[model samples]
Target: MTSPNAAQVPTIKSALKFFKVTSYITGIFLILIMVLWAIRLIWSADVWIGGPDGLIALAQFSVDPSTGEKVGLPGPQIPNDFTTVSLIIHGWLYVAYLFGDFRLWTLLRWSFLRFLVIALGGVIPFLSFFTERYYSKVAEADLKKVA
Candidate 1:
């Protein structure tokens, strides 16, 4: 049996809690992308660090079309050249983040423009961490003021 006015008070704890959870999830996704990129760069030297030498070597070797003989011709480079496991994980996680972002924005009555920036946090490297920290601080401060 609480009074109507009691409900009017903003609950900072709840807001902070939501922010923290979403931040953690998003950060994990970003880290995964980075890890994938590193693995691809290190293990698949023929594509990245090997540069022109690796490229040339990779291109000239193929199987003979008619005789099943191993033919040496420059073949197309791996399509995953620009991608890694990180990109795939990050992409899916980003869509999930959108749902969380919308939920939080609705809860906090945050502006659409601010929400857009938050959503864009995934594309840029290390940006999500900074954005999460900044938003967490802002939400915490707001909660304190309400208290």
Candidate 2:
């Protein structure tokens, strides 16, 4: 039979791995959402369809009589499907990331303020990458002491 202490060790190690993986995944999702949102914002300005009237301007296509080549309009607005999907996925990823942060923080018995800082990593761009590295190192060292 495994001792209580030995059982706890594996649980703690597994928790740490969970935190590490989720942090990376959350960070990636946040970056993707930010990029997609920016593109959507920029593209919105060029959209031909606008106003309550609807279909402000139909997509203009013309045939070049000289060459008989059909030419498409420039800056045709595309749908925001990518942006919408990224936003939704990132929201869910942030929730998972928070769960990971909570588990590690409580296990380590870190301060509540520290927990807040770790949580912010998901919302702030580029913060998750740095925070994950720092948190992992500190948690590992603390776990070594406990083990």
lDDT of 2 by residue, 1-147 (tens): 122244466776788898888888989988887765664455432223442335543334456789974355443234423444566788998998999889877666788998999999999998998999998898777767666
Clashing pairs in 2: none
lDDT of 2 at 7: 45
Tens-place lDDT digits, model 1, residues 1-147: 112223433543555565566666777777766764565456533223233556323222345678964344233344423333345666777776676666556655677887888787767666677777887776555545555
Judged by whole-model lDDT over C-alpha atoms, candidate 1 comes out at: 0.57
lDDT of each: 0.57, 0.71
In model 2, how large is the Cα lDDT of residue 75? 39
Best by TM-score: 2
TM-scores for candidates 1 onward, in order = 0.55, 0.69
Segments in model 1 whose C-alpha atoms lie over 4 Å from true places: 1-12, 41-88
